[model samples]
Target chain A: MRLLHAVWTDMRFQWKHGFYLVYVLVTIIYLIILSFLPNDILSVGLPLVVFSDPSVLGLFFVGGIIMLEKMQGVLSVLVVSPLRTIEYILSKVVSLAFVSVLAAFAITGFSSYGSVSWLLLFLSTVLTSGIFTLCGIMITAGCNTVNQYIIKTVPYMLLFVLPCFSLTGFPYSDLFTVIPSVAALRLMLGAYMGIPLYEAISLVIYLTGMNYLFMRWAIRVFENKIIYQN
Target chain B: MLQIIHLKNDLRQILRDPIMAILMVVPLLLIIAFKLMVLYLVPFIQALIEFDILPYLYYVFVFVVIMCASMLGIVTGFMMIDDRDGKISELMSVTPLGRNGYLINRLLFSSVLSVFYSILGYYVLNVVELPFVTILFVSLLSSNYSIIIGLLIFTFADDKVKGLAFAKAINSLTLFAFTDLLALKWLTVLSWFFPPYWITLVVQTPHTLLVYGLALLVNFGWLFLLIRHYRKK
Candidate 1:
């Protein structure tokens, strides 16, 4: 119940701060660009757009949320509350993942309405957003200001974003599947192009495991940096 | 004397955080990365796909310029938000550094850094053969654009969270330069409203006095409007 309330409050907070509006504007822009593309090009471009923008939206938004809470001293209050650190982290991941899912669906639907594998797309967006949100939480944990968080976020984003080059047939690209973002992109691509069911299932399982590990890491970092002040 | 102290404090603040130091070097790194991509990757892709991308290569330089300027603007904008949150802005408004002084210190800081970075980015990119005066004029105008960005974020966002979102929106305005590349005549006109668009305009036509005048007018016009709104807030 408390976790639900936290998620609700976060949604409200994000809405009040115009995150949803930003997403809407960004989605419109994506749709407009996608509309202009020929089908042959969009067959490849749609997944890339979904993977880059909506799927990683959490990575961009979570820093602002965490920095705001930190600056406002909300974390200090929540620390003393009965809210477990894990629950706080879960609220953020879930609320942000909710937004990312909506955006991914909207963009995918608009670009290739009937052809997409909805199931694979949903799982990919959710898991990818969760992974990036955790990464955002981990990076923002030690930072005091938004500027610090923004700067620190670059290398981490590069860590994830760079691996996607493997999708472009960069040499030795198969090795990139070890990274969760690469897995997520592969799954997203699976939604566009039919992958073997077993491969799809395995990627889903792999991403879920990655999410759990990232969540654990996020919790540890939050507890240490924000809660314990270490 | 007091301004020097402010400058020192700003320097110390940036130095205290290793991330800021990295940010200082990021533009140079970006320039090198862009140069590398243009030099190696573009040709490699051309060879592989048999497509020519040479005609659109100028967009890379524009991206570097806007990116360098925007990063500085974001840094200074967040600094202002931090000051607002810490109540430092309020205190400074009453001190020897009045509100304008407080605002000037930050905007000037970002603008100056932007000038340095823009000039450096131009030399580092070094593909298009621009005259020295043109580079200086464009860099000066970019500093003005950076000031407008800083002031916009500081004025519109009451808190850091909002500031971050607002900063993202402001940075997206750089896309107008890409929009200018589009052949749609109406759309290109719309791009003129954006300050960074003028940077692209001036660059594309380096000898155009009208573009230089309009770029200055538009950038400073936005700066003036934003300053008024900021002071009102």
Candidate 2:
């Protein structure tokens, strides 16, 4: 309860900074511009090529914030505060995740053309990406220096973010629900194609479960040892 | 007792800082990432449909504006942290070196870096629509905005490491946003209000010398303010 309160306050602090709000507003304006393109290209191709996947944008943006704290030793300072590792990670997950989801929803909702089930797709995106973001936290947690973290993460981002566009076009098998972003992509494509919702729901369950377990392991890592140890 | 030599040495110490690497990577990141994207995407689309060169030109304008303006805002934020963390200003204040000397070196380095990044960005667009000599001036103005923003941020850096990290974050955000490419065809209304935003407009139309002129005025205006602030410090 206390940690949740602290997380809420932390979000308030971030909101007061006004940067996130402005960035989202900017993204909204960006999507509105996309709304004007010709239907043929706009519907099929424009979103993929021009907008690409907005999901990646959220992860990269939040990852940059996490990476900054690591770089500036802000995490180190915060670690000594009256909070547990779970508390800290949860704060980021709760605060940054909501804004990121909001950004993704706004972009996809405004631009994408598909069934009314797009809302479900957006929710699946938010949940599915939880694992990836957790993976980001776990992967980035133990780095020695800020530059080292960036070097490590950029390639991973290129690996994930680049291929994501192709996935929307390609048809990976049902087993793809196991791969994190793939599950999210499946949900989006399903919604766009108006495929059945059962698979989407099932994939969402797997994503949510994986995200749950990942957080458990991540907590252990935090409790057992110092992260960002050089 | 940290002298000019120490300042030079400090510069050498964290050259490979993540923030610095991000700063260095950013121009390349925006240009190359978007260009490769276009390269792959254009072929994919064209296979299914016909095309006009306007799409390609639109991309050029998009990237140029997005990269230029973002470079302006983010570099400002990063330099702020750099100057603050390194105890650089205080150390410099104690030395016989003029504030102008320290600031001038920053300008030189940042300008060179900005230009290098801009050239890479320009080349990426060249495969589509390389702006004329006039657009080159616009690129230069965008680069100058970066250098000036660095100076502005330098005066505001809370500390050196913070500066370094802020540099990386700001640079990353700006690159991801890529202001110029946001939306095209009717984009002039929104972007042209900002000076760096005109880089693409000038590149596309070449008639908006006034936009480039205003960008210069804004940059010089900031430069003057930065110098005045440094003197007070």
Measured by lDDT, the strongest candidate is 1
RMSD of 1: 2.1
Please state every model's RMSD to the true fold in angstroms. Answer: 2.1, 5.3
**Which regions of candidate 1 deviate over 4 angstroms?**
A112-114, A169-172, B49-51
Error of 1 at A31 (Å): 2.9
lDDT of each: 0.84, 0.56
Question: How much of the true contact map at the interface does candidate 1 reproduce, as a fraction?
Answer: 0.59
Give lDDT tens digits, candidate 1, residues A5-86.
9999999998998888877877876776677777878988898988888888788878888888886789889978998888
lDDT minimum window of 10 residues, candidate 1 chain A:
A106-115
Q: Score the docking of each candidate (DockQ).
A: 0.64, 0.21
- Best candidate, TM-score: 1
Evaluate candidate 1 and give its CAPRI docking class based on DockQ. medium
After superposition, the stretches of candidate 2 with alpha carbons farther than 4 Å from their true spots are A39-82, A105-115, A139-151, A166-177, A191-193, A220-230, B1-11, B14-26, B29-44, B54-83, B97-103, B120-125, B128-136, B148-190, B207-215, B218-233
Q: Where is model 2 chain A poorest over a 10-residue stretch in terms of lDDT?
A: A46-55
